[model samples]
Target: MKISVFAITATTIVAVFAVSGSSPSAFAQVANRPVLVVSSGVADISTLDPDRATNVGDVGVVSEIFNGLARFAPGSADPKEIQPDLAEKWQTSADKKTWIFYLRKGVQFHGGYGEMKAADVVYSMRRAADPKRSSFAADFAMIDKVEALDDYTVRFTLKYPDSTFLGLVSNYHGGSIVSGAAAEKLGNKFGQSPIGTGPFVFSQLVTQQYLTLVANDTYFRGAPKLASITYRMILSDSARELAVSTGEIDLIGGKREQRWVKRAEGRGMNVDIFNPAEFRTLFLNRNIKPLDNLKVRQAIATVINVDEIVRYAGKDVAEKGCSVVPNGYLGGNCGSGGYTYDVARAKKLLADAGFPSGITLRSVVSNASAQQPIMQIIQAQLAQAGIKLDMEVVDHATYQAKSRRDQSALVFYGAARFPNADNWLREFYDSAASIGAPGAMSNFAHCSVADSDIRAARVEPDPLRQLMLWKQAQQKIHDDVCAVPLFGLKQVWAHGDRVRFGYELKGALNLQPPITELTTVTRSAP
Candidate 1:
């Protein structure tokens, strides 16, 4: 599909449309508006609902189509740079348990919905707090109440003081405010047809093919430079790279390998290797058979060489992950170091655990280019220590499902959160978040070794006390061998020379170079 550049006026309204596979060419007819066709390494999207966004593709699209009370400044992923969005300003009580936000009046929602108000904020916050409606319910577990003080004002009461409260309401994850009217009217269909007050409006989604979003002419931050964006699902790396090289697509998620980065640059494409890196870690399921033994878990950790993995991944795109909290995040405990890679130590540990001959571990792995290679390297390394890794290779979606269902003895997963220790520790290391728990999120290891430290760190008002608790939690997880922290793979993307993101690509919380209001495409370029 193709689109060209144009302008929107006060009298003009862009219509949101969806088409079936039969009408694949519908977007090609959009007269003068240019379309930025981006390629994601997924077969399709699961949902467009901001509250339930888990996949990187879904979050990237949701980031453009929605707005939270506060937002990380455009072109940067640093939490310290977060600024007001739908909310004009905010203040917290002396005890830091109560918060008040003043709304920006007259801001219109997409799809003819009425102006946003304090009630919508209250509704969205309450929706996020409900586990049935959100995958991020744990993020708001501390919230006691959210109320509309007036049409232009909203207030929040927390069960305990949290230094990371600002991040809980920022434009990431469940903090994205939904249109209360749209949520009520659309109901379950809201995921398919989302309406928010951002620079982009959801327009068309041709499943397995492309999802298109048109510009919001009445965007609070003014209109986007590009007329629209078409996120195309291209599962093949070589094919996607070819498409971008031939100018068939504006941008494509590049393979997370050093050679791939060099190859793209050689082809004269603009390669953006941005943060925060998805910290890759192999979690030994504490609930599983052999993995339940501490020596077995420590043996597995010792055999894996994170330094070799980083070298294989191309040092430019990967960093040695030192702790569970990841290196760049605030309150991260990287100074403590990680498991030393020693084949002899691994063999000794395995023998001490009563496995002198050999031991085999089953793991579900994603076949995506970014993951498959890393797993393969680990498998080879593990074999040297008489540890056989029986990897169940599956598609990314299937891998995620199986790992969460506790189907694998080992879960090798990677993710980039909001750059905070509490966010990572609470969701992955807390006992309340273990898989199969009543309100489970992503604790694939079924790990509870650091639950006390994680919990204590959250409400610890003393800055040093909180920091120490976070470090203690990480140290416990590491010493207990709950998971082996591997390497952090930075996001790799390549774009055509004609496209300009209008900002230096540094980091994006969505794990991609976000196409924002300032991003533009020179369609007339040869």
Candidate 2:
């Protein structure tokens, strides 16, 4: 297996719309205006409430319908580009534990939910802090309390100083503010019929079929150019390609493979490969069998080949990963060079751990288009050094259920977070987020070796010291062989030439080029 590192640059492949026969009446009646239809390889979004959103598919929809106190400047994933959204201005106390935000006046919520104010922000933050209410409740563990100082002013008192608090209030996850009145009225059904102050309003959802959104004419930024948007859930890659090629879809999530890129370009589709790449890692379950031994875990890590995995994923779509914290993130460090790949050393270590012959480990593998191929390549690579990986193929939902219950000895996971090391480290490596723990997240490794460094980095005031703490945590995790960092796969999407996204598409945190108030679709000359 050969290791190849590609430049971290956005690339284009040459990829707009005619509605399919099955499109709804809203899509048909918009002759004077354009209707943007988009397709992605997802069955459907699980929720519209931003607090409960656990994956990119749900966040993408929620982003269009909600506004946070702050937001990433459109078309950028960089944390430095964060700008004010519902909050016109904000300031923090001298200790950095208390933050204050002044809300923008006259920003109306959808469905007649009325204006957004400090009360809504307070209510939303409270909801986000409750474990039962939000998947990201642990993220708000730093907040001591949230209070409405006045109609337009909101204040947050944190338990400790957190450098990433600003991102927590930005437009990604729990930061997305929901209407207090609407949430209380709708109750559990609020996820289905969400109301917010974003540029788009949720119109309809048809289970596993599709979702529709209409332009919010009362949007704070201004009216969106497209009259409506049809977000269709097309899981089949062939069907999506056909739909986009036949003018049924203006944009479609693309495959992260070189062949797919060339094929889309051949069909005249404009392809966009953007950040932040979803970082993949193989987490070794310490509680499971032979993996309980540190030598066995180290042997497993030594046996696996990351270079082979990157080759299979294509250098254009994937970048070699070397840190427990993802590469290219703030406080990220890949300078340790990672563990050297040596099959002979792995076999020797396994023998020393009482596995003289070989050992078989079971993993629950998802049949999702993007995951199966990578897992298969890994299985073969592990077998080369006497580690047998028995993968139980299952549907994505089943895979999630089984993996959560600690059924897998090795968990292959991929995720992209707030472009900060704290977000990734705290969720995936912290002991508190270990599976089965209260308010558990995706800490599949049950790793606690770097808990002190991880916690200290959060409150470290000096920038240099803070980054050093983060690097120390990563080094500890790496030395412990808690997880084998694989590769970072960039997001791929194709759009029609007629679709003009008002800003240059550099990177989007939501995993899709956001359809904003500025985005427009040109109509054909009659």
Candidate 3:
């Protein structure tokens, strides 16, 4: 949802009165004061560019300055229950092929970019669909057309009925709206200096240091409690923990390493560990040797003890993943309940697949501390099945590029957002979504079963019937061993007492904090 900065002035006045004695001068002093020092993790955020930001760090900064058609409140983590942002309310056709959104009026873009208009929504969606624009939201190719019905209305026509359309719009990567006039004037650099109707206006951004934002008094939503917010970049997790402990920072995003959780909790800090709507999995490249065989894939999947990995990773940190889709996802049936930790079956499968001394499979993974132990466990498990596994760890950016380029035989990865059954399943499996293709988002498994099932499910409209088709598709994905299901990601964040905001366990990291709901409490004199 869109958050206009216009309401800040009025909000500050009320907030000050509510907290301190209702003296005008005292209220002014509190209103002008900055409240929180937030650690936004490591990454350069100088460019307020959303399109180029593939990392979570950049998205966090961009989210504060920009907004989309719909948004989520911080305390409420449900991605499905999207509240009014730019659009007050919307409706879908009976067939689900058409969607009409009613826009909120009188919203002004930051930096006097322009007034909110239906044309702007149309322009943003069209630009995202355009190949030349290079939007991360290009996966929305499922949409056939977007039309501006009027100054305060926009309509979307899909190729077919898609129950997941709203979920797709909630994707923070490229779903945030941009002014058409600004895009025309700035061209490709429009993303670098985005102007939106959010609670915060872009003030200054420094690389690998901090992102500074000032409250937008012209925000349409109620003004933010904090006069200003600085997203400080802290590289080391320990340093981040220290910063929060010493009251140097206010909040720490995402899950921290297990060792730091206890230390942070000991300091009387609130450690929020929630079940996220994302899943992590191991992708088996069918184009690669050994993994090309279904038996080899099944052997690998059966050998790896997910329970053991969950134990090592910290039980509270993750849930065991049984299917490609996470447990709470729409159309997710947790698979046919077939996967089991049977080392004997793994060995037999490997032998039947022509592995005398096991197959040597190359596995690539990101350099996160949590991932290292998981990979080691997988390696040891494979060895028990007579499969010799070689592990290669690389930096996150390098790993992402390598996985996309299809250079790795087997790779460990996760989906950042859950966009219904269609986008999540079809984009990753449809034959049209092979690596290097336009619609491809996560097709690392390279399985024909995924391709066939996605094609059939797309045309099915009946909700119950479509779910059955998706179930079959998931079962086929499991049987093909396209990718070994791993576990659901547990979202954990730490916050100092000075800062207060709500968040959910879905969408991109930035989408969680409904900027309007963010409140910065003053420190009681200790």
Please tell me which predicted candidate would have the highest TM-score against the true structure. 1
Q: Model 3 has how many clashing residue pairs?
A: 21
TM-score of 2: 0.92
- All models: lDDT? 0.85, 0.85, 0.69
* CA shift of 124, model 2, Å: 0.6
Q: TM-score for every candidate vs. truth? A: 0.94, 0.92, 0.87
Residue lDDT tens for model 2, 65-142: 999999999899988888999999999998899999999999988867789988999999999989988889989989
Better of 1 and 3 by TM-score: 1
Go through the candidates in order and give the clash count of each: 4, 5, 21
TM-score-based ranking: 1, 2, 3
Worst 10 residues of 1 by lDDT: 4-13
Q: Model 3: per-residue lDDT, tens digit, 422-523?
A: 666765655566676665556887766766666777778777888888898888887777777787666567887766563433334452343442556466
RMSD values, in order shown: 3.8, 7.5, 6.7
Please provide, for model 1 over 1-526, each residue's C-alpha lDDT reduced to its tens digit, 9 standing for 90 to 100: 4552222211122333422222212233344556688987888888999989898779999999899999887778888888999999999999999999999988888877879999999999999988999999989999999999999999999999987788889888899989999999999899998989988878767788778787776777776777788788889888888888888788888988999999999988899988888988888898888999999999999988888999999889999888888888878987668888889999999899999998888889999888888889999999999988899999888998999899999888889898889999988889899999988988888889888889988888898999999998888888888888888889999999889898888888877777788887777643
Candidate achieving higher TM-score, 2 or 3: 2
Which stretches of candidate 3 lie above 4 Å from their native place? 1-31, 45-48, 51-53, 134-138, 254-259, 502-517, 523-526
